[model samples]
Target: MEQLLLNVVTLVTFDGAVNWTVGFLTTVAIFAILALALNIQWSVGILNFGVAAFFMVGAYVSAVLTLPAPEGLESYVAGWGLPIPVGWLFAMVAGAVLAILLGIPTLRLRDDFLAIATIGVAAILRSIANSVEGLVNRSRGLNGVDGFLEDQVQGGDYRWVELAIALVVLLAVYWLVSRATASPWGRTLRAIRDNEDTAKASGKNTVKFRMGAFMLGAMLMGLAGAIYAHRSGTISPLTFSDLLGTFFVWTMLIVGGSGNHRGALLGAVVVGFFWFGTPLIQESLPDWLGSRVFQVRQLLIGLLIVVFLLWRPQGLLAERDRVSRFVTRGPDDRTRGGDQGSVWERLRSAVSR
Candidate 1:
């Protein structure tokens, strides 16, 4: 009986560890996607504080299109029971459309006004979802949302499958965004970001590029929303959490290295683990302080963000100012010493002399 009890305890502990790891990876994957989406706009000098609007839109779009109609939801706006891919595609489209609509009127505003306008846009969108019974089921929130590969995921009991799905999507987005940012249009976008007047005077369409970046970012964010909705098997206003959602994603982007996609992923992994871990740690605290656990967690995360901003504003990994081309060197490109392994080899030989 003693041995059996010990074995049971060991099995439980191992299972808990696996669950924890799976949750961490899933959080990192979803947040990494959000960070990358925000970076596309932020890196190009757009301040999109209303990203949650896109997130909410995506979640609802995917849920409504893919989920089978709930028994009582027959009189509601209703779901089409489409394939998961179709829902995701529509989600991306919806996000891009929303971005374009918002950008047309508000992108002209710069800095603080732009942020405020975007925030208002988000508020308006959320309000519509809540007030309109035909839409988003009147904020009752969708349930029984299905995953992309439900059978393979085993109803989420096997968390590894969900993590794999999230990671694969994250990598694909990274590759596409990287290519976009390295293109000629991307260079033009950067020029406009650096100096709008200069880029405009030089014949670049500043407004158009800015709008494009905003739309692109919104699409990625929408994709993230779809993933979260399906992965969690439900979504509601509670998930968005007003400023809380925006705060962590922006923090991740800034803390990980704002300008690079890799930085976004890094920030997501590093900060996401801590963010998710705090709630678990709260359970060990005294009952008196348990009520304020959420506040304490936010305080800790906020403090870390402030510290990073004050001391290491560039983040753990800084963005490169210029692209280098080192592999283009030929035999003639070598030092006069005739095909030395590298410049370092000649330098070493001279030093030995």
Candidate 2:
């Protein structure tokens, strides 16, 4: 047993830990942006399940745009030779456009139907990415794109600089989201989320508001995607695989407590640590145990999701009241729970009363 323990410890040390503090902080910045995107949709627009598609779109756009012209492709499009910032901006614009297009078809549908449509859209997007050689360089993926910050700093202690930049971006996003949610535009979005018909009757353009929320949310997600692409120094269709990457974003948003940016950021950091830390911890176990640890870890993650859904569906730091409290009418108003209650139950309650 002692020998086995020693071997495990040695493996971890030998594996050579990357500067995890920097890696983790970078992940936090990325997922915090993603969670805020979802918050705009789910918390403010009552939309769900389309975030993955937006993220994938953003990633692909940034990667493809930043990629140097491949031999044959040079004939058709000129390489911009732009910096990562410009690439990021392009990605955001693509995200917004895609969001508008997606919203046009799915936003008109009711909840479950909308979810199905959005999931289908995500699948379609992934399929196109996998098949389109001209667009995403097919299955081979984008290579040689410069890391966003690689040129900005150099040498050993650069991780500190990376952390500082991430913090600054995080703070800026917090301010933006907070201000938007506090604005009248945000109030309209909340009303639409809580009660679309009421919001429409109250002189708000519900459809337009939902679309705007989705587009803005998508823009944030795109910014994150751009950062991630540069952070990794390359990207592939596989990078945005719904199972591997998209689900993690969902986990971060849920764990952080949707609706509030701070909760999203905290949730992202906590979940990012767990996602990376678990594997590190497992690597230190006996070889016999480490071989099976991945499966066990996945099982635990699944269990955690189930438990959180049942006991804390709103998440760890969910608001006691939503951010749009000023526009809210009453305490017992059905809008309090929004569209979460079963339609039949709502109807039955109305009839009973």
Candidate 3:
């Protein structure tokens, strides 16, 4: 009897650990997607502060589309009961549309003005979502939202499958953005970012390039929002707060590496560690500190941003040098220093030296 009880306890603990890990990783992948979206826009010098607006739009859109028509005590616009993929697709379209609509006017503004405009847009959207009772059921929000593969899988096993889905989507977006950044178009975008007047002097349409980057980033944020909605099984106005939706993602991009996609992924993981891990540590904190858990999390995150900005603002992974394979010469071609191997190898060699 004693042995059996011990075995049962161990099994339960192990199961809890697995569930926690799966949840953490799924959250990280979602944030990575958001961070990548920001990286895409920021790479081309579009200062988008309305990430939360697009994210909220995606979640509400997906939830409304997938959910069945409200029965009683539940009211919202358009519960189409569509398939999840269809919801995801339309969410991306909605986000892109919103981006283009806003970008047309705001993209021409200076950096500070653009940020202020985007943030104001986010605030407007949040108010609309919160005050409009007919839309998204207002403060109550849409609940009973289905998880990815929830009908096919049950219990903790479902989380693993969801995590797999999130990771797959994350990798697909990563590959897409990485390829885009390595192309001639990406080169032009970066040139515009580094110096808009110079890029314009070189005959590039700066506005067009910036608009493209803005829409693409918004679409990715929409996708991430859809994934997040499904994972949480619910989303409310509070979920898309400026801190969680906007500032946190900005920090991820800044800490990861603004211009580099890999930096975005790394920053997501690092910030995610603190974002999710703090709740666990809160239990050990003194009563005064433990009571203000939310504030404590914000403090830690703010402190992290400050420390990184003061010391290593380029982030843990700096952006790679943008060079065309067809135009730029490698070490061997330039000075016969054998092969420098891949980009990673060169970075490692430089760091070691």
Model 3 segments more than 4 A misplaced = 1-12, 326-353
Residues 1-353, model 3: lDDT tens digits: 01101122233487766666777888889989999999999998788887899898888889899999997888899888899988899889989998988888778877777788889888998888889878788888789889767898868588778889999999999999988988888888999988889999999989999999999999999999998888787888888888889999989988776788887998899888777766666667899998898797888788878877887676766664544556455534534323456656644653464
Model 1, span 1-353: residue lDDT tens: 01101122222487766666676788678888889999999878999888788888888898889977656653345577999988889889999998988888877775677788878877887787767766676667777888877866565375677888899999999998899888887788788878889999999888899999999999998998898888888676656755555778888887887877777887888788777665565556798777687677678778878987887676655555543346444444433233345434543553463
Regions of candidate 2 where Cα sits further than 4 Å from its true position = 1-18, 72-78, 155-161, 286-289, 322-353
Residue 204 miss distance in model 3 (angstroms): 1.1
lDDT of 2: 0.68
RMSD of each: 8.2, 8.3, 5.6
Of candidate 1, the 10-residue stretch with the lowest lDDT total is 1-10
Candidate 1 vs 2: which has more lDDT: 1
lDDT of each: 0.77, 0.68, 0.82
| Candidate 3 Cα deviation (angstroms), residue 191 | 0.8
**Deviation from native of the Cα of residue 42 in model 1, angstroms:** 0.6
Candidates sorted on TM-score, descending: 3, 1, 2
TM agreement with the true structure for every prediction: 0.85, 0.81, 0.88
